[model samples]
Target: MAGKRSGSPDPKRHLWVLGLIAPMSALLPSQLVLYTKLEVFWWIGPIIVLIVIPVLDWVVGEDGTNPRDEDYELLSKDRYYRWCTYMFLPVQLSGLIIAAYMWSGDALSVVDKLGLAATLGFVSGIGINAAHELGHRVEHLERWLSKIALAQSAYGHFFVEHNKGHHARVATPEDPASARMGESLWEFLPRSVIGGFRSAIHIERERLKRKGHRWFSVHNHILQAWAMTAVLFGALLAIYGLRILPYLVLQAVIGAALLETVNYVEHYGLLRRRRPNGGWARCSPRDSWNSDRLVTNIFLFHLQRHSDHHANPGRRYQTLRTSEEAPQLPAGYATMIVLALFPPLWRIIMDPRLLEHYAGDVSQANIQPRKRERILAAYEYRAAA
Candidate 1:
C-alpha cells in the first residue's frame, strides 16, 4: 500500500491521525448523550471547543510545515480522496441515529444533554466539513456524498454557492465571506451568512437563467435548501414537539459559527491583485490557507491543505497537499481560527509579516496577475476622485 512504503512516512502519520479523528468524532456525540440537561450542556460544548481545545493546541501543537516530498505524492491521490468521502457516511449516520435516540429519551440530565449537543455538533462538523471537501470532487459519487453531508447540516445550498461563487471571489473585496484586514469575527459572521445566502441565490438564479429555467422552480438550489430546512424543522416539531426547536436552532447556529470561523482563518490576510483590464487575478495556491499539521489535517480530511483546494477545486480532500509556495499557517486550522477570534492579538502577530510582504504599501506589486490590474485601476479611480 502507498501508506506503507519507505518514502511514505508522513502518509502513514496522516493515516494514524485519521484513525484518531474518526473515533474522536464518533465518541463526541456519545459523550453528549451522557449530559443530563440540554441547556447546561449546550454552553459546555462551546467552552470545551473554543476555550479548552485552543489552550491545549497552543501548549502541545506541532509546528506546521510542508509535507515530505514522497508523502505529498502519496497523499495527493484519488484513492485517499474517495476514502475521505466514504468515512463521512458513518459519522453522519451515527450522529443522526444517536440524536434520534436522545430526542426520544426526553428530559435528560446535564451530562446526557451535553453528550447529545456534542454529538450533534461533531456530526454537523462531519457533514459540513467533510462535505465541503467532497463537494469539490469531480467524481459523481463523491459529489453526491458532499450534497448529502450538506443536507445533513441543513446548509445544502452551500454546495452550490461555495463551488460557483466563493472560489471565484475568495479573498477579494467582492467576497462577503472574506474578512477585511481589520474586521472582527463578530462583524464578519452576520455579514457573511446574509451576504453568502444572497450571493448563492443570485448565482443560482443566473445558472437557472442560462438553463432556461425559472428562478422559483423546484430545481433551484436555494428553494430546495429552504425546503430542506423546513422539512428538518417540521420533523423536529413532529418528533420532539416545540421544546426541541431551540436545540435544533442551537445546533444550526453552532454549525454555522464553526464554518465561519474556518472562513476567517483561511484567508485572514490574503488578497488578490487586479488585472489591467479590471478583473481579479485567478486564485493560486498562495491565495488560500495551507497547513500540514498531521492531526488536524486528518481530522478535517485534509482541509488544512486548502491551497490545493483553491488551486484545483475538483481535487478530492484526501488528495490535497501543501503547495511549495503557498503561505502556511503556523499550526493547524483549529489553532489559527482560535487566534483569529482575538483581532488585536492576530494583528500583532500577522500584520508585520503582511506589511513586509507588501513593503508597507498596498500596490499592484503586492497583488497577483489580473488582480493587480484591477487593484491598480481601483487606486487610479480613487486618485482621480
Candidate 2:
C-alpha cells in the first residue's frame, strides 16, 4: 500500500459535495431561465461543464493529496460519499422529465430546445462517470444503480463490458476503447461504441452459458440493462409523444460521444507489454493517465486518480489514491476533452507527451494500424537519433 498524506483533516472533505454540480447543473439552467426569463440559460449545462469547470480547474489547480491509509475504511464506509453519487440519479432523471415537458409544450424555440438537449447531454454524460464508480462495486444495489444511471444514455451495456472486458484488455491492441497513437477521437468513437457493445454481448452470452441460463434469459445482465433503457424511453415517449424524439436522440448521441471522448483520453497511446508466458502483463498504475486537478477530481469523483482506480478496481471512489508513477495529463479531463475534439490540436499536444513518456520510443506506445507506418516514419528516426 502507498503511504498516506499527513493532513489532519482531508482538504477535500467538503469539496466532495461539489460532485453534485454536474447533475444539479442540469436543473440550474431551467431555474435560471425561470428567474431571468433568458433563453440563454438553457445552454448553461455545456457552459458549466465545458467552460466554467475548465477555468475553475486552472484556478483551483491540482490536488495531489491522498487519504491516510487508516482513513480509507472510514471514508469508504461513509454514507455521505455514497449519497453524493446516489443523488445524481434523481436529479438527472428529473432534468430529463423537465426537459421533456418543455419540449412537448412548444415553450422552447428550436434553438432553445437544442440547448436544453445539449445541457441534458452533459448531465447524461457525467452520469456515466457516476455509473462507472458504482459499477465497480461488489454490492448488488450499487451495480444495479450503475445500470439505471446508464439508462439515460442508452449505454447500459457499458456496465458489463467496462468491468469485464475493457478492464481485462485495457492498454492492449485488442481493446477498442483504448485509443492508439495516430487515431483521432473521431475515428475512435464509433469503433469503441460498436466494439464495446459487441464485446459485452459475447461476454454475457458466455457467462449465461456457463450458468445454464439462455443468453436471452432475463438474468443476462446486458439484456437486463438494455431493457431498462427501453422501458425508460418508452415511458417518456408515452407521456411526451414523438415530438421529443429528435431531442432524445440528440442528447443520447452527445452523451455517448462525451463518454467515449473521456475513454480516448484515459489511455491514449499507452500499451501493456507481453510477458514471457505470452500473456499480456498485469495492469499497473502507469497504464492509465492521472490528473490531480481539484475541480475535475471532485466532479469526476476522483476519476482523475484513474491509475489508482485501475490498479484497485474494487476500491470506492472516495478512497482512490493518486500514484506518482502514472503518466499525468497536462490538465484535467474537461480541458483535455476540448483538445480531443480537434484531431490536429489533440495530436500536437499529446503525441509528443506520449513519446516522452516512453523515453522517445515510438514502438512502446500503441499505434493505429492504418497510420502505423506513417507515424513510425515520422517519429522512429527522431527516436533512434
On residues 75-187, what C-alpha lDDT tens digit does candidate 1 reach at each position?
66637446745776675656555565565565575455555655466457545787787777677787767766665557777877788889999878778777665566787
* Error at 142, model 1, angstroms: 2.4
Cα RMSD for predicted model 2:
2.8
Report lDDT per candidate: 0.65, 0.89
Per-model root-mean-square deviation over C-alphas: 5.4, 2.8
Per-residue lDDT over 164-234 for candidate 2, one digit per residue giving the tens place of the 0 to 100 score: 99999999999989999999999999899999999999998899999999987989898888899899899
- Predict model 2's lDDT versus the native: 0.89
**Residues forming the 10-long window of minimal summed lDDT in candidate 1:** 363-372
Candidate 1 at 143: error in angstroms? 2.4
Q: State the number of backbone clashes in model 1.
A: 32
- lDDT for 295 in candidate 1 is 56
Instruction: Compare the candidates by TM-score and give the number of the best one.
Output: 2
